[model samples]
Target: MSELSLKVLAAGSLRAVWQPLMTSFTLQSGIEVDTRFGPAGLLRESIEQGERPDLFASANIAHPQRLKALGLASRVEVFTRNRLCLTARKELLAAQPSWLALLGNRALKVGTSTPLADPSGDYTWQLFDTLERHHAGLGEYLQQSSLKLVGGPASQSVPNGELAAAWLIRGGQCDLFVGYASYARRLRLCKDLAVIDIPENYNIQADYAFAQCYEAANPLSDFLLSTAAQEILFREGFARNL
Candidate 1:
């Protein structure tokens, strides 16, 4: 590896966008990046366990903020935003009258990431809370019945290029999966599935944040917030930090 190269730990949801973003950054800045993408919370644990990457990009602000609080990182900033959505088997869609009905069906399975090990899971939990607030007992049922299928330390790894929600739902692992809306477009392409948006009132907004673990990553950090990078993120299913 080049001495000027930087190691970056980023959330798995960024995998699709990060490639193009980094390509542009390297072309302009002449700095190579070695990136590992996974559940943001697990990446944070790796950092806490002495695996030091020059930069950490998280799916949620909380994980990065926790690192900053632990004196392991600097200047947490929200770089992008995402929202939660549901991906369900096409057969399930035909059976249920609505996404809400599909979720409330006691026989159908729901898959979610593991909480505390992945920020996506945390957001899934938050979405459940919103559901409970609006329709008492519904959220609690989801929380109880949902399968923690991915994102935990011991969870099965999602094949590198496959969309987890679609993969799981197609394999009959779950009738429905709750995950980042960033995958909405690609998931929609799958013939076996349907992407359903969580209503704005019930959806949880995911704030993607990043922090520099080493001063050497400062330029990369600055580059991420630039107009070029922001545009790429927006094109790839993320929103500019508002």
Candidate 2:
């Protein structure tokens, strides 16, 4: 273990790839990283409340930009990108004529993370907006009906190593969940669940951004933008920031 250390606060969606990424970083730079993962918006609230980590990575650019605006951070960079996806029970998917029709079904429960507290929820809302633009009134209907299942301050904690979407669906909490496409690979492994891709026309691109909260994070920050790190992100289902 290195005496030189860095503290990182990252979005929960990064949890799958973060360990390997940091391990590589530590091997190359001899700096140990202590990281915490959570909803990006709630993580930002902690920063605003004086929980200063050396680095802060968010699922959306807005939170990091807010930190920069408040002078709590510097050098906001879009590190990677993701897209919104819908995960539903396999049976439910087969019964519906289309994914959009599945969502439009009044009796089916729709689950989403809490908006303003989690970027996934915000992106899901954006998807709803796109749906409404094409279908009229659909966005309002979803916004009004979607259950705020997780990612809020009051939301239940998902068990370690369990995908929330899978857990929720298996528990019969919701018929479907709107979340990040990065988890599609893992979610697909669940026998009873199906991952549905949001069309390019209706999908929202989620920009994952990071900022340097302290000078100690500079090396890691620079490394994140380097080819080595970008390649790792690419393999982990994230698209590089072009």
Task: Quantify all predictions' global Cα lDDT against the true fold.
Answer: 0.91, 0.92
Cα-based TM-score, every candidate: 0.97, 0.97
Q: What stretches of model 1 exceed 4 Å from their correct place?
A: 1-3
The segments of candidate 2 whose C-alpha lies over 4 angstroms from its true place after superposition are: 1-3
Pick out the ten consecutive residues of candidate 2 with the lowest summed lDDT.
1-10
> Could you tell me how far off, in angstroms, the CA of residue 42 lies in candidate 2 after the best superposition?
0.8
Tens digits of per-residue lDDT, candidate 1, 61-110, equal 98888899999998788899999999988877776858899899999899
Q: How much does candidate 1 score in TM-score? A: 0.97
How high is the lDDT of residue 186 in model 1? 91
CA RMSD for every model?
1.2, 1.4
